[model samples]
Target: MSSKDEKNLTQVTDKISAMDEPRRSTMQRVHDVIMTAAPALKPRIWYGMPAYAASASAPALITLRNDERINLALTEKAPFRAAGGVDGQLMPAAWYLEDLDDATETRVAEIVRSVVG
Candidate 1:
């Protein structure tokens, strides 16, 4: 990794480390899931939060932030197409996560994989 990328990773780690309770564990788990699902995505810090992107020059594909609730969001850069409402008219690009069970984690991994495509 480059020096700047290393610094960004450190900042993200610090941010995650500073979180309290379920947020910390949840973010860490989500981060792990994202990485495992899409190994090409590089982790970095964006807006003081953990973010992943194809490259530093590219827009972030995913970002994680935790406060009252944990948020896992896919950026506009991601191929966010979902088939639900009226021939895929309505789609969700972001999700609020409280915790991750096996099923939820698997779903999250699937989402990340789809986004990676």
Candidate 2:
């Protein structure tokens, strides 16, 4: 079983480790940020990706995707209040992440804090 076969991976770290490089490093960085920012969210494998949720019985609050791009997606359970929610306004629930610089890390931390709080 190769690491690329993420379906059978039940552990969060294993799944992230299995990914191909730059993606793998990016995912790992995101993983660290998420856990540090929102320690309440339990780490697990959800739909073959690294997912964080409130508990074993709760839905995932955030999920990371491993594709051509590293994707960060928030579930409906995440109370992420963006600057828009009006009739004609729209907010991005997901983002394709590349690098985790200081600014990006801060933003990610803020988002996870908001989600968990």
Candidate 3:
């Protein structure tokens, strides 16, 4: 990893480390999954949130939305074309993860691979 990328990951780790309870634990799990599933996605702290993108120019394909529970956003960049609404309608591109069950984790891995591919 480049020094800049390392620095960004460090910042993201620090932010996640400082989070309170379940949020911290949840984000850590999400981080692990993303890092393992999509090694090419650069980890960074985006607007005080943890986000992963393929490159500096590309939009974040995965981000944490933990206002209440752990939520993973598979951004519009992915082949999950249903995003941003069907036939030009607008829609949210996030999924509320109650927990990382085996099936859910498997699906998440598949989605990450699809997005990265």
Candidate 4:
């Protein structure tokens, strides 16, 4: 990672640490799952939210959004495809989570490993 990226990752981590309640804990776990599953993905902040990318300044592979629920979005440009309902003929861009259970973590890890390979 570049110096800029390292700085940004630190900034992103700080932001995650500062978040309130479930979002904070959820994002941290998501961060860990992605990093552990795919060490090649670099953590950063995108649009003021936590995101992971294939490289410095690249578009996010997955992003954590604190909406009505926690959202783990797989970018359209990402390597592996996600299965879900269609949106005007296009697949939905992400997976939503109310909580990170063990099953969810395992599935997320499996996706990350497949994509990062």
Candidate 5:
């Protein structure tokens, strides 16, 4: 990683570490999921939050905050886009599968693999 990217990741980790435990834990869980599933992708801090992509390539994915929810933002330029959410609504900057149950986690793993592989 470049010095700038390292700085950004450090800033993100610091900000997340400062959050309350519940919120921090939630972000950590998401981070763990992304890192484990997409080893080729690098995690970086974007707009004070965590984002991952295939090593500074095009099509970045971001984790964004919307009200009480956290959502993933896959670039509009991404080959695959999530369906159903309207643009510029109260929706998050990106779309992620709503039900993160065991099945959903597996699906998320598959999606990450497809994108990063």
Candidate 6:
């Protein structure tokens, strides 16, 4: 990793480590799930959060905030078409979802597989 990327990762890890129990647990759960599912992926800090992708060479599929929310940025036209009428209104490659549940977790794993596999 570049020196800048290492610094960013350090910042994100520190921020996540400082979160309260609920938020920290949530972030750790999501991080664990992603790491388990994609053993080859690399993690980095992006937008003040923990982000994982197939590699720094690939696009990020998951980003977890210290506030215990997971952010999924949709990069394909399919997600926009599948968004239906969500409040965020899909915008090609700019869709993001927060505060996911168990079902959301499954859905996220599917999305990650599709994107990174």
Index of the highest-lDDT prediction: 1
Candidate 5: TM-score? 0.65
What TM-score does candidate 1 reach?
Answer: 0.88
Once fitted onto the true fold, the runs of candidate 3 whose alpha carbons sit more than 4 angstroms away are 83-92
Candidate 5 minimal-lDDT segment of 10 residues:
90-99
lDDT of each: 0.84, 0.78, 0.77, 0.81, 0.60, 0.59
Candidate maximizing TM-score: 1
Candidates in order, TM-scores: namely: 0.88, 0.82, 0.80, 0.83, 0.65, 0.58
Tens digits of lDDT, candidate 1, 63-99: 8977677888888888866677674776778888799
Q: What ranking emerges by TM-score with the best candidate at the front?
A: 1, 4, 2, 3, 5, 6
Flag clash pairs in model 6.
Answer: none
lDDT of 3 at 109: 76
| Over 4 Å off, model 6 | 1-12, 57-59, 66-70, 74-102
What's the residue-level lDDT of 47 in candidate 5?
59
> How many clashes does each candidate structure show, in the order listed?
0, 0, 0, 0, 1, 0
User: C-alpha displacement of 69 in model 2, angstroms?
Assistant: 0.9
Q: What is the per-residue lDDT of model 6 for residues 2-112, given as tens digits with 9 covering 90 to 100?
A: 675566557666777787766676666666666666666567776666776556656655665443344455333222334456635544343244545788668666655
Pairs clashing within candidate 5: 73-94
Q: Which stretches of candidate 5 lie over 4 Å from their true place?
A: 1-5, 57-59, 81-101
The predicted structure with the larger lDDT, 3 or 4, is 4
lDDT (Cα, tens digit) per residue for candidate 2, span 1-117 = 334333333488888778888788888999999989977677777887888888765788988988877888888887755556463356557878787888988888887787788
Per-residue lDDT tens digits for candidate 3, residues 2-71, read: 8878988998898899988867876787788888998999988776788888876567877787677777
Candidate 4 lDDT over 7-78, as tens digits, reads 978987898899898789988898899889988888888888888888887888778888788888877667
lDDT of 5 by residue, 11-67 (tens): 767766877756677666666677789776767665556777566544466454423
- Please identify model 4 stretches exceeding 4 Å from their true place: 80-92
Model 2: ten consecutive residues of lowest lDDT: 1-10
